[model samples]
Every structure is written in C-alpha cells, then in structure tokens.
Target: MYKYDEIDQTLVDERVAQFRGQVTRRLSGALSEDEFKPLRLQNGLYLQLHAYMLRVAVPYGVLSSRQLRGLSQIACKYDRGRGHFTTRQNIQFNWIKLEEAADALADLAKVQMHAIQTSGNTIRNTTTDQFAGAAHDEIEDPRLWCEIIRQWSTFHPEFSFLPRKFKIAVTGSPNDRAAVRVHDIGLRMHKNAAGEVGFEVIVGGGLGRTPFIGKTIRDFLPKQDLLSYLEAILRVYNEFGRRDNLYKARIKILVHEIGIETMREKVEAEWLTSRDGALKLPQAAIDQIAAHFAPPAFEALPGGIAREYAEAFRTDFEFGLWARRNTAKHKQPGYSIVTVSLKKEGAAPGDASAEQMAAVADIADRYSFGEVRVTHEQNLVLPHVRQADLPAVYAALKAYDLATPNVGLVSDIIACPGLDYCALANARSIPVAQQIALRFRNWERAHDIGELKIKISGCINACGHHHVGHIGILGVDKNGEEFYQLTLGGSADENAALGDILGPALNATDAVDAIDTLVETYLRIRQAGERFLDTYRRTGLAPFKEAVYAAA
Candidate 1:
C-alpha cells in the first residue's frame, strides 16, 4: 500500500476541516439543503431513504490494517456497527447522522483515508483486480498504474465535474476478474509484438439504464502516454457528452451515438496535442510510483505444496471446501490469495460488522503483510497469505463467521441495497438475494452447479451489475407490486456479453424458483466439464427460458 506523503496528508486534513465548517454552516442556517447538496456530495455523503450514507473511498481497493481498524472504529461510533462493501471496491456506511458527517471524515483522515470523489459526477475510484500483486498470471501489477491515476485525477480541475459519474478499471491478468469491460474506461495491460507492455484502452463500457460493453479505441498505447491519452478521451467526452438529460450523460451513450471510429479519431486528434506535453510520464516518475507496489518480502519456501495444507485438505472437509472455493493461485511460490466471503447465507451480500472488520484486520496483520484488499464482487481479500498458514487463517475466519465456502457460486450473490435502503430503488434486493442464497445451502448441490454468478439490481441503475451476471435479476415496480425480470447467459469475463432476458416479470417467490429451474435445466443438459455460462452460450436462451417459464 502507498503511504500518504505530506501533500496527501495536508489535502485530506484541509478537506476535513472545510467540510466540518460546511456542516456547521448548514446547521446554523447559513447554508440551505440545496446549497449543501454539492458540497456534501463532493465529500461522499448522500441523503438516502432513511438517513445519510457516507461512501469512503478505498483507492484501488487496497487498505492497511491501521485503516481497517480506523474504519471499524468509525462504523462503531457513527454507523450502526456495520459497513457495506460496494461493487466499486469501496465501502458505504448507512444510518449516518448529518451532524457527524465531518467528524467521520476527520477520523478517516487520521488513518490516511478519505471520502473525496466518491459520490460526485467526477472521476470516481479507479479499481483493479483484488489479486493484483499476488496473482500468478498477471502481466504486471496494475495497482501502480491505478495509484498513478489516483494521484493525477483526485481534485483534477479539468474533470472535477464531468457530464456524469465516471468509472475506470484496470486488469493485468488475461482472465478479467476486475470486470474492466463494464467501466467508463477499461485498461488491460498486455505486451504487443515488440514484447513491451502497454495498455489496451477500451472506452464507453458501462452498466446503467443503458448497458454497453466498451469498444477498443486503441489496440496498444505506450506506457508513457497513458495520462495524455486518458485526458484526450475525457476531453472528447467532456466536450460532447450529453448534459441535458441525466440518463444519457455517460460516455457510453456518446460512444453509442457516434461510432467508435469517430470517437477514436477525435481522441487521437486531441492526443496529438497533449501526448508530448506535461502529461507524458517520465521513466523515473513511473519507477517512483511502481516502488510503492513492489512485491512484499516473501520467504523462500519449498516450491511445492505445503504438507500442513495438504494434510488439512485431506482431514477437514469444511476447510477443504472453503479452501477450494475461496482461494486463488498466488504468484509467490508458497503463498495464496484468500477471499473472505461476506455472502453468508441469509446475510446482506456485502455487510460486515465492525467486529468482523477488526478481526479481519488482525488476521491480515498476522498472516498477510498487514494489508487487505476489497474485491469488486463485494468480498475482502488477504492477498499474500502463505499456504502453510491456511489452517490457522481458516480457523480465525471461521470464528468470525467469515469462512463461507461460496465464492463464484449461486450463493455468492452481488446485490444492491435496494428499496430497503436506497431512495432510488423500486423493489427489495436484499431479501431476494438472501432467499436465493438460502435455497442453495446444500454444499454438494452448489459445488455441482459451479461458477454461477447471480446479480440483482433494485432498479435499472445496475449498481449490482445485474447486466453481466450469469443469471441477472432486475427488480421492477408493476402496479404497486414487486417483480423481477430475469436475464440469462450474461458474463463479465474476457468474453464480455450482456444477458438476454429469459421471460416476463415474476413475483419474488417465483423468481427464486425460476433461478432454481434454470439451474436444474443447465444441470440436465450441460456437456462434460461445461459450467453454467458455457452451457448457456452453447444452448442459448431457448432452453433456460422455456424451463423457467414452464415451471412458472
């Protein structure tokens, strides 16, 4: 994790003081609610259905143990003992008091964290894969680049307020775990014919009322010109992106209106002006940023399976299941990336209690270089855990109720805080996700129906990223009743594709059953070694649609 320098510390402290004064002014009648709206939003506060929600930015989803403890403290004092990890690799605290907003930010700044640029119509957090430094298949660590972007874009005068909220994601692995294709700007790092690593820039990919898989604007952009090219793209979008209507203000809509070719032409023309200017990154500057993310000190353990890990897998069935589901390959010979699943049966998809957060922080400090990571799938990660420590880590997590063996399964749902919390939501999302997760409690059955992603959105905003789930459930209001529309065959991997609707809307109970029906249909007809997504792509929507509706 990059430690905050003097400039970063000063800026955060000043922002905290400024927001504290603004809150005081609002309380003293010097500022009206309308007047305080933008100010509060710029600081990551939102007026939700019941209370104020403050979103704290976790840049590139990396956190220090000290920062996690700080967040846990804030959650205990201000929020109702819990925080919700979001799809964008940030955390949100509901039930915040308007009077304590600035106080919470001040506490965050003490730990070198803040909420700036978390909610405004500006460039939000730049996210990347949870297993960035640890992943075995990475082309390079993307967090260094993400940190560079973070420094450049935070409080940037040019893009402070774009036409709408913009998101950017980066991935260094061939397998797209970060869902880069669904962001405003997606950068995939790869080596070209010359064997020099650069970015494959994709633009206009977003999920909202209008979902789009971004188009590749540049096949290969040199590392030195990343910022200049990004500036050029944002310049094009800022000049021409729709502002009259909120629905069409995103860059995705702009790209859809004019083809990718024209968009590329404009960006290239704009880049020609700034590519050689101050935005061009010098090699020394790149190294300075890269040094912050250099690999953690790793011991030279034997380059094979640890005896204790293998013995635990053979002896403890539950531990084995959790290890198989919740861990990923690490680049270091003896290390593994452990994902602490927050999607326990009947719990909100991403809610972690203050106690749980503190416990994970302690665990991370003991086993994983005192660093923690948040995933886009709403989970916590210990990115550098040694395989020898697997048993102890599992035991500690199991004590805290964090050892749920359900990653990438049906029970591992990604859902938005629907009507229960959000003022914009039309239907309930938490209850539906809870019910569906409980339906798949049988481990044997869940493992058999492997690698299924079920995402739900309260409305069309796609906060839960329902557009890219293997089975996407969208909540809609129909004549004063809650209903869900299902979509099948969607994926957010390297082969990104939007799901096709399976049928008409169904009530909550029937929607849950419809998911089961769809799963059963896949189980019956799937070929050898085919996952749900592969079967769907091969069979298309006809079978899943017919099965779901027929059951209904």
Candidate 2:
C-alpha cells in the first residue's frame, strides 16, 4: 500500500475542512438543498431514499488493517453497524446522518483515506485486479500504474467536471480479472514480441442505457508515455464529448459518434504535443511508486504438497471443498490468495457488519501480512496466506460467517443497492438477489452447477455490472410494477461479451423460477466438465430461452 506523504495528507485535510464547512452551512440553512447538491456530491455524499449515504474510496481495492479498522469504526459510530462494498472498489455507509457527513470524512482522513472522486461526473476510482501483485501469471503489478493515475486525476482542474462520469481499470494479467473491457479507459499491461512492456489502451467501453466493449485506440503504448497519452485521451473527450443531453454525455457516446479511427487520430495529434511534457513520468518516480508494492517478506517453504496441508485436505472434506473453490495459486510457491466471500446465502452481496470487518482485520494481520484486498466481484482477498495455514484461516473465517466457499458459484451474486438505497433505481435489486441466493442455498448443488455469475441491477445504469454476468438480470418498472429482464451469454473475462435478452421481461416472482428453469436446462444439456458459461456458449440461447419463457 502507498503511504501518504506530507503533500497528500495536507490535501486530504484541506478537502475535509472545506467539506465540513459546507455541511455545516447546509445544516444551518445558510445553503439550500439545491445549492449543496454539487458540494455534497464532490465529497461522496448522496441523499438516498431514506437517509444520506457516504461512499469511501478504497483505491485499487487495497486496504491495510488500520484502514479496515477505521471503516469498522465509521460503521459502528456514524451509521448503522454495516457497510456495503461496491463494484468500484468503494464502500458505502447507507444510514449516515447529513450532519455527521463531515465528521465521517475527518475520520477517514485520519487513516489516509478520503471520499473524494468516489462519485460525481469526474474521474472516479481507478481499479485493478484484486490479486495484482500476487497473481501467478501477471506481467507486472497494474496497481503501480493505477496509483499513478489516481494521483494524476484526483482533483485535476482540467477533468474535475466532465460532461459525464469517467471510469478506468487496469489489468496486468491476461485473465482479465479487472474487467478492463467495460471501463471508460481500460489499460492492459503486456509484453510485445520484442519483450518490452507497455499498455494496450482501450477506450469507449461502458455499460448503462447503452453497452459497448471498448476499442483498442493504441495497440501498444510505451510505458513511459502512459500519463501523457492518457492526458491526450481525456483532453479529446473533454473538448468534444456531448454536453447537451445527460444521456449522451459519456466519452463512449463521443467515440460511438466519431468512430475509433478519428478518435485515435485526434488523441495521437494531441499526444504529439504533450508526450515529452511535464506529464511524462521519470524513471525515478516510477521506481518510487513501484517500491511501494514490493512483495512481502516470504519464508522458504516446500514448493509442492506440504505434508500438513496434504494431510488436512485428505482428512477434512469441507476444508478441501473450500480450498478448491476459494483459493487461487500465488506467484510464490507454498502460498495462496484466498478470497473471503461476503455473499453469504440470503445476505446482501458485498456487505460486512462492523464486527465482521474487525474480525477480518484481525485475521489479515495475523495471517496475511496485515493486508486485505477488495475484488471487483464483491469479495475480499488475503493475498499472501501460506498453504499450510489454510485450515486455521478457514476456521477463523467460518467463525465470523465469512467462509461461504461459493466464490464463482451461482449464489456468489453481485447486486447493487438498487431501490433499497439508490434514488435513481426504478425497482428493488437486493431482494431479487436475496431470492436467487436462497434458491441456490445448497452448497453442494451450487458447486455442482459450477461457475455461474448472477448480477442484478435495479435499472439500466448497470451499477451491478449485470451487463457482463453469465446471467444478467436488469430490473425495470413497467407501469409501476416491478419486472426483471434477463440476458444470457455475457462474460467479463478475456472473452468479454454482452449478453442477449432472452425474451420479454418477467414479473419479479417469475424471475426466480425463470432462473431455476434456465439452470435445469443447463444441467440437462451440459457436456462433461462444462461450466454454465461454456454450456451456454456451446448450446446458444435457444434451449435456455425456450425453457424460461415456456410457461409464461
């Protein structure tokens, strides 16, 4: 994790003080709601259905034990005793009082965290793979560059008020855990044929009322030119992106209208002037940022098949199942990256109670070098757990109801706050997700079903990333009635694709049964060892769609 220096600390403290004054003014009636809207948004405060919600950024999904404790304290003191982790690698406190928003910001500042840029039409949080530094197949640590972008884009005067919100994601691994293809700006780090490292810069990728997979503007951009090139892209978008209609204001709309070739030409022309300017990174600065992400002090252990681990796997069936589902191979031998699932059956996805947060912090400190990671899939990762200690870590997590062993199964759903908390939502999302989870509560059945992603969003905004799920559920309001539109064959991995709508929208009650029918159809038709996605891809939507709409 990057520690804040004097400059960083000063900036955050100043922002906190400014927001505190603004909040006080609003509460004292010196500022009206209309006047305070932008001010509060800039500080990551949103007026929701029943209360104010405060969203705190967890940059690139990394958290230290101290920061986790700070979030727990906020959950305990300012709002309800729970926090909701979001798809953007941020956390939200749903019940925050309007008057205490400033106090919450001040508390966050004490831990080198802030709510700045978490919302608004500015550049939001820059996210990366949960297993950034520890993935076995990573070409480089993408967070090194994500942090660089975070520092550059935070409160940048040029981009502070874009026509619409912009998002960026970086991925060092070819597996695409960060879902780079669906971001406003997606950077994939890779080595060329000559073995020189750089980025494949993809632009125009977004999901909302309209969904589009980003196009590669630059096939290969030199590592040192990242900042200048990024600036060029932003400059182009800021100048030409639509400002007339809220629906057509995103950079993706601009790219769609102008075409990728023209967009690239403009960006390249802009870059020629700024490539060697002040934004060009120096070798020393790169080294400084990279130093912050160096590998932990790992001990030498046997490379393959530790005796104790093997014995435990042989003896404990449940632990073995969890190990297979929740753990991934680390770059270092004898170590693993363990995902702590927050999606316990029938619980809200990506939410943790204050006590659970504290317990996770304690476990991280004792077992994983005092570090934890939030995943884009709404899970947490202990990045450096020793293989021999898997049993103890599993037991500790089980004690807190965090060990669900359903990392990629059907029940490990990703859902947004929807109508439950979001004002923009047209229908409820959490209840829909809860029903689906409860339907698939059997762990053995869920694991057998295999690698199904069910994402739900209360509206077309796609905050739940429903557009990319294997089974995407989008909530819609039809004449004041709640209905859900289902889509199939979407994926967020390397083979990123948008799902196709199966049929007409179904009533909320029928939606769960529709999912059941689709699953049953898959199970009956799947070939040996084929996952849900693989079966859907091979068999197409006809079979599943027919089953889902047959009774309707």
Candidate 3:
C-alpha cells in the first residue's frame, strides 16, 4: 500500500492526456492501424477477436479498497460487468472500445493505478509474492525491492524497447510462492553465511514457445547493488538478444544460445562499470522505500487455535474444508491469510464480476485492513484477516459465490482467454477449462485426489503458464481441427521443472477423460501422503502417459 507521490500522480496524468490525444488522432484517421499499433500497445490496449482489450496493472498484485472499487466501476461502466485477472496478477477488460481506452486509464490514475507497462516489449509489471509482508517464513518484504525496480524501469531510456518483453519477480520466502524461477529475472532474498542480507539472482528464466528454469547468475549479491546488477543484465540482453525472429527474441533464448557461464561473465563485466553509478542505491533510500511497506497495526493475541475458529470448523463441515484448504498461517497472532477462490464451478478462471469485486472490497475494508492481493494463481488474498472474523468473511463470500474451497486442487484451474477473446489463439481455452472443472465438480472426490495444478493455454504463447503446471494442457490446431496436448510433472515452485509431453495430442472431446485417467492412475500408484507432483516425480511419466494414451 504505497501511496503515490506528486511526481507519480503528475507522470500518470500526463501519460493519460498524451494517450487521449493519440486516441483522438487515430479515430480521426490521422493515424492508420499500423501507425497506431505501438501507441496503443504502450497504453496497454490490444485489439482482440471481438473488440478492444485493456489490461490494467496491479503492481506486485497489491490493491487498496479504493483501487478495487475503481476496477469495479470500470467493469460496470465501460466494459462488461466483469474483468479477468491474469496469470501475471493483472486485470483485463475484454470488451473495451477504442474510444474509451484513454478514459479508463484516466479513471485508473485517480486511484494511483495505470495500465502502463502491462503489455509491450518493455519491462512488464514487477511481481512478487502476494503474501510478501504477512507471510511468517519471509526473510524480508520483497515488495520493497519490487517498488524500487518499478520506478527504475518505468520509461528508462535504455530499456524502453528491448529485444522482447521482459518480466521480473522477487520472493522473500524460501517456499517460492511467486514462481520466481520462470520469470525473465528472479530475485530471491536471503541471508548469507556471514548473516548479511543479499539476493540470489537468477536470469534467463521464461515460458512461452520455449520454457526454461532460470539459472543463478549471482549466488549472492549485496542488497545495495540490485539496480546496478539489473541494469547490467538488461544492457547485455539489449545488445546481444535476438531481434530478427519474434519466437526466439526473448532473453531466455539468448541465454540458451550462449552458455550460462559466458552469460554470467558478460553481465559481470557490464556490472563493474555501473556498480557505483547513479543506479547504486544508498541505505537511506532503501530505508525510505521500506517504510512504505511497514507492517499494519496488529494486536497481540494468543498464538494457538482460536475458540471461534475451532467451533466453526466443528459445526460446519464445508467451512472447515474451506478453512483448511484456502487459508494460510499469518506471521501475526490471531491473523490468517484467506484466499478467495475465483475458480467456482463452470465459471471462467480468474474472473470476478462487478458485484463480486464490490463485495470483496467491502470485505477487505471490514476484515482485512482495507487491502486485497491478487495471486499469480488467479486467486485473491485477504492477507490480514483476523481468525475471529473467519466465519463472517466466509459467509459474506458465500453470498457472493466466492468461497470455493479448491485452492490447489484439480478443479482450481488456470486458463487464458484463448480463442474466446485473444486474436492470436487457435483454440478456445475457456471452454476446455470449463469442461475439466465441471468433470471435477465433486469437491470430496477432488480433495481425496490431493493437490494438483491444471493449466491450459490457447496456444504456444503460454499466457496460461501451461508449462509450469503439474498437468499442463496446450491447445493446438491440427489440420483445421482443434486438439489438446498434455504434459506432466511441470511445477513452478521451489523445485521448478518443465512438464514433459505425455503423448500425442488428443481430440478436444476426449481431453477431460484423459485427465481423469491420469488422476486415477496417480491415485492408484501414489505412496502415503504423497501429492500429485510427488507421485509423478517418483513414478515418472510412464504410468500417467500410459493411462492417458490408453484411454485415448
């Protein structure tokens, strides 16, 4: 919850005015579609299959009640009565008109939010763990560094347009909730052997047409040299990254072409020149940035289980299940992190209706210190909820249909807006996701099957993060017919790995059955207390692939 300063407000307002004029000229035929493409993209507007789509950035996935209300208003007034939360922890309006794009951005600026850098080839939103400040296991609040990088990267002259789009993620926890390993650059904060805080810098990690688990370039970098090191990495990529082919233009491909050892040498050479330059952060500045992310006022209470929470769990079986699945331990006594699931049965994943947004905003204000967080898994988090308020929060969410208990289960899927909205997509991902969700609607059965991640992408672009799911589903068009390809053992956690292809692509109609077969195979072969991923890792792909293809 960093409040915008005067400089931040002024820059956003100016950008809105500039884009408004640009939009006017484009509508008046002063600029053609080809000429206007970059301008619109710079403002986070895309021409999709049906209409214009506008993406709004939620920095580090953090939002205040006021910002959530602003998004709800935009969804109610300008576009449809809903908005789609993305895998990158941003929100998208799929039915925006070209004329209203600037107006939407203007409204966003009023709430200290903007759509800038949500798209295009510049540094996109700098994301981090949604539970950054509240998580008990964190070494430091990663959002402090995320905000520093956000200001440094915005409109930087040298990196405004690179070889391809870049993404950066930071994690303060050892558990890696932010999916740091799959980003263009991943920063993990930890203490060194001497007990001094520093970063483990990983670069060249990404997933698209090609997937890679980023290699660590710097084992331990001093905290003060973050910007200098990042500048060096970007400089190397800007100069040497491929630009001729869009498919091979990402920094991941560049790192692949040159070995990690050579890439590290080049970055180290570049870093020597910029280490003490203007980008080198002073301790005072770091302290100033850290002040903005200080912990909220918390009351001291008993650390053990609360009486009300225990009673609710005993009385209500459904609430007990949801509490166990969707809540995480909070660092402060009597507080918990409550995940509000958007993956209700038969609905589009990560989508929230206008009314639901308003309801969530209200709940956040009343029970979670007026703050909400969007997770990379397409869920919302009330990071500071009191244990005593659990029942009330659950009841309110139930009224809004936001209390699904499937946080990491099979039905809690991740999907992109496929052919339904995206022009680049060849097949419809939403329908495929919906079919699978419906097939797994039995909550008890899904819970019994244990933790599983099912991610679906409309194409190879991997917007859905299909490559990192425990069960990855990619939609492909073969000879004008839609087919679905499956991959297994992919994970985006502390043990990050790319899923291997299970077998040949199966027809769209048979995709759900194939998933069932895979799940059944896992259940039969899994050892005691082993999760889907653990079983897959132990048993390998032979069992799951054999079952899926046999059913096919």
lDDT (0 to 1) per candidate: 0.95, 0.94, 0.94
Query: Candidate 2, 452: how far from true, in Å?
Result: 0.6
After superposition, the stretches of candidate 3 with alpha carbons farther than 4 Å from their true spots are: none
After superposition, the stretches of candidate 1 with alpha carbons farther than 4 Å from their true spots are none
State the lDDT of candidate 1 residue by residue for 379-459, as single tens digits: 999999999999999999999999999999999999999999999998999999999999999999999999999999999
Taking the tens digit of each residue's C-alpha lDDT, what string does model 2 give over 1-552?
A: 899999999999999999989988998999999999999999999999999999999999999999999999999999889999999989999999988888999999999999999889999999999999999999999988999999999999999999999999999999999999999999999999999999999999989999999999999999999999999999999999999999999999999999999999999999999999999899999999999999999989779967767888999998888899999999999999999999998899999999999999999999999999998888899999999899999999999999988999999999999998899999899998899999999888898899999999999999999999999999999999989999999998878999989999998899999999999999999999999999999999999988887866
Q: What global local distance difference test value does model 2 have?
A: 0.94
- Comparing 1 and 2 on lDDT, the stronger one: 1
Evaluated with lDDT, which candidate comes out highest? 1
- TM-score of model number 1: 0.99
Clashing pairs counted in every model = 0, 0, 0
Structural similarity to truth (TM-score) of each candidate = 0.99, 0.99, 0.99
Error of 3 at 170 (Å): 0.3
